[model samples]
Target: MNTNPATIRKGRKFEQVLEGARDIFLRDGFEGANVDDIARTAGVSKATLYSYFPDKRLLFIEVFRQECDRQTLAALDQIDLGAPVAEVLRQAAGHMVASFVNEFNQAVFRICVAESDRFPELGAAFYRSGPRRLHDELAGFLAGVDGQGEVAIPDAALAADQFIELCKADLYLRHLLRIDDSFAPEEIARVIDGAVATFMARYGVRT
Candidate 1:
């Protein structure tokens, strides 16, 4: 990653376009968002926009992909390599829950779920870009911790998937459906805490 000024400026402009496109898509849905409106929102000419993204579909998918990547990266930052497996897993689960509660995540997740049928590419791109990476990173970490006999997971990938599912099941589906009920902080804490406890009961180090 070189730190050239021109590259930095272009990157910033591209990010601006993605932000604008995301806002438009959330407000108007994919079919209603126009490239010209995105360009105006980004304060760039349509020509400049094309120089970055060739079409609205690509731009829209990238916007959602970028949002997913941002959330994944934030969660990645919280992993503590030196911590015990159960502790690390608890932290990871908590981070996962907190990430979905963010406003940007709620909006982006809504768009991804709603447009998944019409824009399969967008959904595929999101899985490839975000959840796939998270799964890989989590599996890698679990392998390390398992090697230390801190956990009993025979297959880290399966364990990671299970962990994600258990942590996200109700939270994700409810949020996607716009369910009126909201999880209180205490409730969220309990959900994540219980998930981790159950995982440890199955996988934690035995005396």
Candidate 2:
């Protein structure tokens, strides 16, 4: 699959283009998104839009990238790195669940999966910006705390993955399967506490 789109060039109208693209993509999906509509909404000529993003696929990926970046930054800004271990996990897990269960993100995931065979880059891009980035950040946090003797994680990467998977126990899967949409705060708290206890049981220092 020639999923790799052309290089995205940044210009003065870049943000303007993305602003328009975001609205269109949200309203109409990747396949349904029209370049003409994108240009019209962005308030730029076809030539201008094409100059920044050579192909539709590239533009789509770039939009997802920017949105994912904003979500990640927002999550990170809420986290206090120096906080206690359980509290840190709670905050991170809450954000992770919220992001995964987001309607727009779910739509993007379905679209990317359905289209990935034709454009392999879409699925890979989402994985990179979403789960992979989350894993890396969690692993870094675990490693930092382990060094300080707060946790005993010898393999931070593995532990990080475990923690994330724990957060997804049933709610995340249910949402993806279309079995359910709304989850009460107590349900989320249950998963968070379960994850924290399961993790602490193994890695907590018994001092």
Candidate 3:
């Protein structure tokens, strides 16, 4: 919100408008979302909703970016950086895996792909708020760990990218392709554990 886009003023009711837009967009989606509903939900008049977002697509994109930020950046704060390398990796992987299988993300992915041609910003927004943010977070953490001699990652950025890709090994593609939706705890554990082991094997400092 205010963190980025300084031009877009955050009024006394800015968050209120966004909250309403989020509710309507999630419940009804881009095409189905109406300004009237968003305004009513936010308890603001139509003028207020229009004042914040001149177009519905803009509102939808903002909400999508907001959700992605919430999912990736906010959740990163909860991961205990002081934990052992393996445990820290597991914690990060666990959150990543959950997001991969989450309904909101799945829906966002579907909508982005479906409407990408018409609303090209959807892809860019997703990348910026989701994968890009996550990558930076992981890369920063790995670099610190490497500096501390806890890991042997010569290329922290590359290792971060690889770790994220490893977590997407099976379930991600399947779920995105609509092959499977069920997220079994055992399956998730397997993915998380394998990602951690593989990363550690490559980067873990030999004791």
Best by lDDT: 2
Rank ordering of all candidates by TM-score, starting from the highest: 2, 3, 1
Residue 129, candidate 1: how far off, in angstroms? 1.6
Q: What are the runs in model 1 whose C-alpha is more than 4 Å off? A: 1-12
lDDT by residue for model 3 over 1-207, one digit each (tens)?
A: 222332355568988988888777768777777888999999999877766777666677778777877777657788888998889999999999988877778777777777889778777777787788889989999988885666888898999999999999799988988899887899999999999999999888887
Candidate 1 C-alpha lDDT tens digits along 92-111: 88887776566666765566
| C-alpha lDDT of all candidate models, in order | 0.74, 0.87, 0.82
The top-ranked prediction according to TM-score is 2
Per-model TM against the reference: 0.85, 0.90, 0.86
Clashing pairs in 1: none
Using TM-score as the yardstick, the better of models 2 and 3 is 2
Candidate 1: Cα lDDT at 102 = 60
Off by over 4 Å in 2: 1-6
What is residue 30's positional error in candidate 3, in angstroms?
2.3
Per-residue lDDT, model 2, residue 149, is: 65
